[model samples]
Target chain A: MYRLTGVTKRYRRGDETVDALSGVDLVIEGGSQLVIQGPAGGGKTTLLQMLGGLDRPTEGSVELDGTDLARLPEPRLTRIRSESIGFVFRTVNLIPALTALENVETALVPLGLAAAQRRQQAAEALESVGLAEHRDGLPGELSGGQRQRVAVARALVKRPKVLLADEPTGDLDEDARDEVMSLLEGLWRAHGLTFVVVTHDSAIARRAPRLATVRKGRVAVRERGPAR
Target chain B: MFFTYLRRELRCHAKAALAVALGLALGIGLVITVSSVASGMRQAQGRVLQSRYGLGTDLTVTKAATPPTRGSTPTFDFAGQSGSSARGDDLVTVQGSRSLDASVVSAVTGQSGVADAAGGLSLRVVKADRRFTQGQARQGGDATGVINGQHGFGGYGGVTAGQSGGGTAGQGGGSRFDADDYRAYGVDVSRPDIGPLTSARITSGTGFSAAQADGRVAVVDSGYARRNNLAVGRSFTVSGSTFKIIGVAAASADPAAEVYLPLHQAQALANATGKVSTVYVRATDAQHIGTARSAIQKNIPGTDVTTSAELAAAVSGSLTTAANLATNAGRWLSLAALAVAFLAAGLSTSSAVGRRVREFGTLRTLGWSSGRVVRQVMGEALVNALVGGALGIALGLAAAYAVSCVSPTLTAQVADAPGSGGLDQGGKAVGDVLHIALTAPVSAATLAVAVALAVGGGLVAGGCGGWRAARLRPADALRPADALRPAA
Candidate 1:
């Protein structure tokens, strides 16, 4: 469960100020899948970053499970990200130096898992995304779709309570995009994970149980649909 | 965990570690070499002073003051009696010329703190062949003719031809013979109370007996006999008097060079009567030197008095300037080693840090505090320094032992010198082995200094890397490293 009350994020660009998100108030219950749809500069990524405890909102509060992530110390927030939140980025998703399996194992490092168990869990996570055979391959050696799948595996390896994906299918072909979306949805449905996906893809938006379209710095529209 | 990290660091930068080790080794080597040499020289000076010259004594007074400039010999004026006049040279020139003055000597010897006393004489003499007219034939030759013929013959002989007489040619061609005149006054050699001649070594025959010491028998130096082609059991005539050579003693070719004979015989030979130049008083302890000096100054007046330590210091001080230059030269070389070590530590640490920026960044992001990162880097540096230092100490000690072994003079000097306990003395070979072992720990100090420099250098490198990493935003850090370009 997460809540944001009057959350505002701003950035200083030399002499000028830029508002990435402002006056945003929203809430999502536990075990819900939410899609944030917006074109470039719609502050979707900024909103997701703030919600994932990777960055703090400039004003108001973003709370997760009744704990205000905005007010937590940076170290504590990093620990929360490692323990409770997993992220899938559009580009630079997996650490290039590590194989798909090692990238997944990296996430479990913060969890204090023994090396053998971490490797086993990483393997299972890769298998879940149908990438078990390619687990030993590096990101540079994988296809665009395969790399995205590896990213998803790394995020899910820790079994985090919330999964945040920003343009997870941005770089993949349409067919590969569908397969990745299907895998994400299957994991969300089977594990009852809270999924917050930031994307401009209408097909992804249509598939989510709930959708919100962001314009400028505010949420302009919301829609509900069947989970399947 | 610390060691694991250090091992990884060293493995990653193997070349740099080797360079550092080599540099440190050189520093250690230099320190060991210089220290050993200085130690050896100091030891040598001490041994020469102690063994060859009975260096531990107070006042060595002679009738003549130390050469070139002479002091007034002490005069004795009996209270309520006439002043006594004795030839300065006659009184102390020969070993026992002043024996009859036992009444006056006993009066002075009875003084408090006197301990024990004796008198002797010293002189220089020339050894030449004695040519005689056995069957009433004309026989005559100058000192130079006799000296040249003796030298040309290469052995003692009765006569030879083409020998030139005394002149500059004589001075250049023949060796000058010198002798020591000594005497025991009213003292029995068998008496423990008598202060015996402490530093004499008789290579053959025996030292003077109380009775024989008063006779014309004399002990010549081994070098003196060898140079003069004289042998023990042979007789030689000096000043028309023949004296048999009874013993040959080892003699120091220093200021104390001389042949030993009874003072009475020496005085008679020199044709001086009732005269003595020196009075040797052996005190009970070193503390009595000053009291004896003051009493003698009061009773005899103007007598120069010195302690054994003072004598040793004075004698050693005369040679210390050269020794000090040698010691300082060694120290300067050691300083150069330190400089080289510093450079090596710096270059290696810098190269290592330059290659590990990414690892450092990972550590920072992994919640390893900045202080811990610095410590790990410094620990790696310390490990390198220690290895190099240990090797250097071994090398240095080995060198010292080798040098001592090759030179007996050096070994004796080291053995006899005060404050030479640290020197390797198990002969030359054992000393060489022990030198390396002993110097190893000392070389460790040099390594420690190098390690400290390396750690400091590492901190500087770490500080620069830390500043760069600290400036990056977390989002930037997590972004693709290539995409997260460094800020200009």
Candidate 2:
């Protein structure tokens, strides 16, 4: 479960101050899939970052599971991010230097899991995302769709409570986007984990259980979508 | 896992580490070689100095420069002086000339620290009035008996530099030779306790007997005998005194006295009895040398009192120049090398850290602390220093070997004068030839310092470079290298 009360974000560009998000509040229950749709520079990524606790809210409070994320210190915030949230960024965010299996295992290390258990869990996560055959393959060796699948596996390997995706389909072709979306939906349905995806794509908005349209640092409209 | 990351980065940037290692090797190698050579030369020179100055003579007491006094200066106006009987006190000392007088000699002999004392008047052969008449035909006097040549233990020939020429007549086949210039060394050969002739070696004929020393019997070096075309038992007639060549001992290159005689006879010969140019003193115990030195100096004011150590220091004047070069120039050069090494190491490590900013950022994201990051960087720098140190030591040894190859040893020239008791005045160095050795005096302490310098330098440089890298935030991982760096 997550809650946001009048979350506002501001950034400095040289001498000029720009509003990134302003006076926007939203809440979603656990095990629901929410998609935030907006044009470029429309505060969707900023809102997602605020929800993931990567960046603090400028003038509001963001709470997850009854704990305020903005008030927590950096170490505790880092602990929250490591244990509760998994990030899947836009460009198929897999470290080029590591294999798919290692990239998944990298997320498990903060959990204090031993090496053998981490390897087995990482292999299972890769299998769930249909990337078990590509476990030993590097990001450079994998196709765009396979790389995105690897990112999904890494994000879910820790079995975090919330999965944050920022324009997951932004850099992928139609076929790859379909594959990554289907994988996310299947994992969310099976594990009953919260999934928040931010994208400009209409197909992702139509597929999620809820859709919020953001414009000019505020959400213009909120509506219920088809079943997740 | 940390090393795995480090190893990957190292493989990606192998050239950087190599450059650092090479730079350090040059600096450390130079310091090791220079210090080893300088230290080795000092050890060799010490041995040579000990051997040059002979044994048993604990301390030497010589005449110091006379301090200027009112009316000490003498003016010889022939018209005013012709009628004035030449009083012994009237003879003023020569300018820049240092000689022992009767009072100084007697006072030195009476000192409590003096176990025994003997005097010698070192005289040079300034002029020769030869009467060489082939074989049996003697022009000036009768032919003296031929004394066969023999080898006797000879030491530094007392080459007295101040007096021109002086001596007394030998009571043999010839008459007395008298002149203020005709000279022979008068030593107290009668007393073996402090005699200058105690360490003397004769290469040709016999040494003087106790009776002969009181007489005008003389011992000459082989070189002197060859130069004068005289042999043992031949009559050397000079200043109308016939000195029968009682013996021909081995000669120094330059000798203060060609012949040895009794101390009293030499004082009698020089027309100045109870006076000597040099006196050899023996202490009752080795530990009393310093006491003897202080006593002699205190008793005889304006005298150069020298211990055996002082004599050794005086004999090693030339090496002092080499020592200065090794000390001032060698140390400065090593300092310069250290500076260059520090800069090279610092700059290279700084650059390496800058290039890996993103790598550090990723590690932080992976739950690694800033402390862990810093330690990794320092570890790499330490490894580089260790590699360089070993290479440097090897190179330094090679350098020493090369130096030894060029000149195995260089002769150290020491000149002993009659007045100073440097027994060998031939400019001959007495001990094992002075040479540079690779391991003569192993520079363990200096080597330790060299290693510490390298490691300490590397650690400082690494810490500096690492501090900037460790402070990097995880946000650094967001920017790709190309975006952060402008197109070259």
Candidate 3:
């Protein structure tokens, strides 16, 4: 679970000060899905970064479970990210030099697992993402949808408590985007994770049980009906 | 995983890695070449000194030769000489060196750092072979006729002039003579280890024995012996004394004498019973030669002392110039090249890291510690440096070998004692210019230095790249506007 109270993130662009997030208070229950939607220059990614402990708020506390991530030291925050949180980004940022299986193994590297165990777990993660046959393939050799699936496998390989993804399908076509969203929903239900996704795609936003729209550094929450 | 990533990255950027490696190699090669050539110069200088002073002679003491006075010229008389063929040999001190008391050898031996000393007499032989014939006087105007091969009938004819009509009979008889001259040294037979004989090797027959110090025996130089067709067991007359030839010696490239005789015998022949032309001294400690020379000069007045170092300093020509260049200009050039190479490698590595900002940022986002990132960069740089080290060693070895193969000859003109035409060691004129072949030798120490420089160069380059990688912020992973977009 995550709690944010009066969170504000500011940036200095030359002589001007822009507030990426201002006086935002939000709560997310555990094992639930939340979709954040916003336009360009909005605070959607900033909200997700705060929730994931990737960045600290200027004047608020971001609590994950009972710990305030804003007050945590850098090493502790990195540890939390490694052990309890998983992140996926659009464009599927994979090391071009590594194979698909090796790319997934990077997530488990920080866990201090033995090489054999890391390899076995990475192989299993590839199988779960339906890229088992392409585990030895480089990212450049894989199709767009297959590479995204590899990224999903990498994010979930460590089985963290939460998954934060920014524009997870922003570059995919309709068919590929639907395939990725279905995979995420299945994984969320199966693993019971606190999944927060930042997306501009309405198709993904409409499917969320709870959606938050961010505009001008402020957020308004809405409860949705059954998926339509 | 670390190795896998490092290997893969290096393979991906092979061109950049090769550039850095080649830069380091050139610098290291130049260093090895310069060092080896410099070492060769020093060895050549030592050889030039050894040729003149013999293997173990550390210092030499002598008195400068003085010009002869009006009545001091040597004379040879053949009056009432036996047989129609009369011969005489005159022994005198070498022209360029004066005689010193034989006691100076013992005095030098007693000095500090003087291990052993021996006195040697340098002498010259002026031999005259003449034939006197009685000629028939003509009862005419000149009353002279040529007898045997004489040019003028001067002496014998005049003696008979009083009995002749015109008394011109003395001008009819004359003599024909041939003069032969050669340089000789009188070595102390008891202590033959420190004098002129140390520089030569006996090729046939034995050298002078201690029992022959007072006996009439001689060792003839091979060059002089070859010209005169002389061999061992032959006898040569000097001042009415016949000395038996006991041995034949082949001298060094710069020979010191044509013949060697016992010191006592030489002193008797020269009519200077207790005089020697030179004193050769061997120091107890070679490192303190200057101390020994100073002591000898202070204790013994009016004596000239010369050391190997002093002789080397007097040497000038191509060898000296090459030595100076190797030690000065060559050293600085190698150092400057290395500095530039290190700088280029560092900048190249740092630029490589800059091009990979997105890659490093993703690793940071994946929770890889900054330390791990730095190690990866360092590992790559180290590999490049090691490759460069190996290449540099090969290049240096080849260059040194090439230098040795060519073996360019360098000339060294060693000056003699001040105002003394040359060192009168047996009147051979010791300090003439010599030609020596130059060699480049690469020692193990030079290779060790090259290895150290290679490693140091690697560390410098790695440090530059690693520092940049460590400062990367994970936030750099997200593009501006904080929204993911398709690649252009």
Q: Calculate DockQ per candidate and list them.
A: 0.14, 0.14, 0.27
TM-score of 2: 0.60
Question: Chain B, model 1, TM-score against the native?
Answer: 0.49
Isolated chain A TM-score, each model:
0.96, 0.96, 0.97
- Tens digit of per-residue lDDT, candidate 1, span B44-161: 4544554323433454332322222244332222122112222222222222122223233454466556776655444334332222221111234453433232222222322423
Measured by TM-score, the strongest candidate is: 3
Candidate 3 chain B weakest ten by summed lDDT: B153-162
Worst 10 residues of 2 chain B by lDDT: B169-178
lDDT of 2 by residue, A175-212 (tens): 98888888888888888889989987888777666888
- After superposing candidate 3 on the true structure, give the runs of residues whose Cα lies further than 4 Å from its correct spot: A4-10, A15-18, A22-26, A43-63, A68-78, A214-228, B53-312, B416-431, B477-488
lDDT-based ranking: 3, 2, 1
- Candidate 3, TM-score vs. the true structure? 0.74
Query: In model 2, what is the error at residue B132, expressed in angstroms?
Result: 6.2
| Model no. 2, DockQ | 0.14
- lDDT for residue A97 in candidate 2, whole number 0-100: 57
**TM-score preference between candidates 1 and 3, better one:** 3
lDDT of 2 by residue, B1-488 (tens): 44544564455456878788778888888888778777866655554443332236677666763444687544322222311322122222211234577566557768877777766565433332111111122233323333222222221112212211232212212111111232356666665445445545677778776676567667766766787788987876433455777777665422345566666666664455666676667787887887888888776777777676665555444455566577689889988997898788878887877877765654454444566678878878877777777777777778866766664444444444325332334533222223323232337897797789779767866877787777665543434433221111
